[model samples]
Target: MSDSTPGRPPALPVTFRPAHTRAVLLTAGAALFVVITLIALLLDHLSPGERVSFVFTAALLAGVLFLLARPKVVADEAGVTVVNIVSRRRLEWAEILQVNLRPGDPWVFLDLSDGTSLPALGIQPGIARQRAVSDARALRALAEDRSTPGDAAPPG
Candidate 1:
């Protein structure tokens, strides 16, 4: 079935991220960072070494929080881009052979024609599941369309 309505654009390259999870992670991180930094700056009795340590800890916490919230998958007309903390990958639409978003799966897996299972971070199973499923349908449709012999999904 077509997901596109007459006035709406076909959904492809759907971005799936657990919004509440990410928001909580970021908010907590920011609050912790700010609190730690302010305490470090305001504590008049802190030794030079302790102040330096607090600064380091605040920076470290912020960095870790960013890393934790850094994974996402984008499936666009061109292909899919899986961006995880510290690494990223791109696969063309024609390269995807299957889209797997089974029960209990953390995210959808793209079974590539090359025999590798690539994770689609955006089409996750938890948090906003309805949206995730809809995105998955869009992904599968796009992948299938591209796999066909003629009139493949737009890829550029």
Candidate 2:
């Protein structure tokens, strides 16, 4: 009953952790929050105007937490969902023109039909090389399975 191609297994969904930068930022933000709270408390004794400063600090902390907690990417049989640090984009399997697994790249960049690229979190070279290879292969497989026979272009 499945519409999937014969002889090719479906791609399993994979969720990648947030990029290392995100973790570092989150940790720094938490530390900053603690330090700011302590400073605010100390200032409380010296000046009544410290309340306004505390409010600004709280807002900044909240913004940082929100950014750090955002999802990076979600991949599945159908396609990949890339949640950039500030935005989200969903690409269907057939729409993916290429996947780059080059060294030094922060993440897997998926080339689209329009010549633009979207990042997949799993392809981060910062992770183990084996993991990057596996993720790249998986993405290649998905692209091949979904593409027409003649459209099996090499990944960039």
Candidate 3:
């Protein structure tokens, strides 16, 4: 019932993520947390409340970095799930009319059947252009392969 069969262009349940970006963001967050915590502990001249504030600020920044590293795209038999910076959306294969990433675009965008475009930030070209291109192509292929002929909308 899936595309795991031999000779298929792609298998089901594929995930695309900005691996390098995520790694850098997460590592930076961890380092920031550690350094800030250490500074808070070492700076005895600062008041207790000020030290607490510094650690709290560090935690807030690290949390933001963690959120920044959370974007990803997942394609499966059911459809595709796009996780952006602060939003998540699920779409059936037929709902995605086209996958687009233009020359100056920062990330992939999905043209929906409803005449709306959704940004797929998980496949960004920030630090990895080739990977983003490949991911966009694969997503396009999957959308083409899985969409029902009559149900698919024409690309505008």
Candidate 4:
């Protein structure tokens, strides 16, 4: 029961991302990756294998850093996408039964109809309290509008 029918008002996607703090981390990671690669290439003391390993290590670290800094949540008319440090999940609006952001929690959690809870790392509490709360409210509103009444179970 998506809320995107032609007659119904379209539900635009609302993306919740960490504030500008990640810019610093992204810049640092990208610089390190480039610098280490250059260093590995310029060092004549290292063998070809060593240079390759060095470059690989730098690339790996950069990839991880980029991932860590790119976590976000994209909620649209169809569903929501949660991108965390190591994994990504997509859930329909109906699948979301509740959105919880307790005082002790670091990030907001989405209570799914399947009895599982999914963490939305983008809406972190401590740093972006206001934005996170706003995001939660928007997500809850969208979920409620999309979940058609009388539907006994979540979308399969």
| CA lDDT of each prediction against the hidden true structure | 0.76, 0.66, 0.89, 0.78
Candidate 1 stretches greater than 4 Å from native: 1-9, 12-14, 150-156
| Model 3 Cα lDDT, one tens digit per residue, 1-156 | 123333344687888899999999999999999999999999879999999999999999999999999999999999999999999999999899999999999899999999999999999999998888888888888898888687668789
**What's the TM for model 3?**
0.89
Better of 2 and 3 by lDDT: 3
Q: For residues 57-131, what per-residue lDDT tens digits would candidate 4 score against the true structure?
A: 998998877887877888776788999888999998878998888878888899999999999887776666766
lDDT of 2 at 122: 40
Q: Please write out the lDDT profile of model 1 over residues 97-129, one tens digit for every residue.
A: 888888788888889878989776656657677
The model with the greatest lDDT is: 3
Shift of residue 29 alpha carbon in model 4, Å? 1.7
- Lowest lDDT 10-residue stretch of candidate 4: 1-10
Best by TM-score: 3
Task: Return the TM-score for each candidate structure.
Answer: 0.80, 0.68, 0.89, 0.76
lDDT, ranked from best to worst = 3, 4, 1, 2
Query: For candidate 2, what's the RMSD?
Result: 6.7
Error (Å) of candidate 4 at residue 9 is 12
| Model 2 residue 27 CA deviation in Å | 2.9
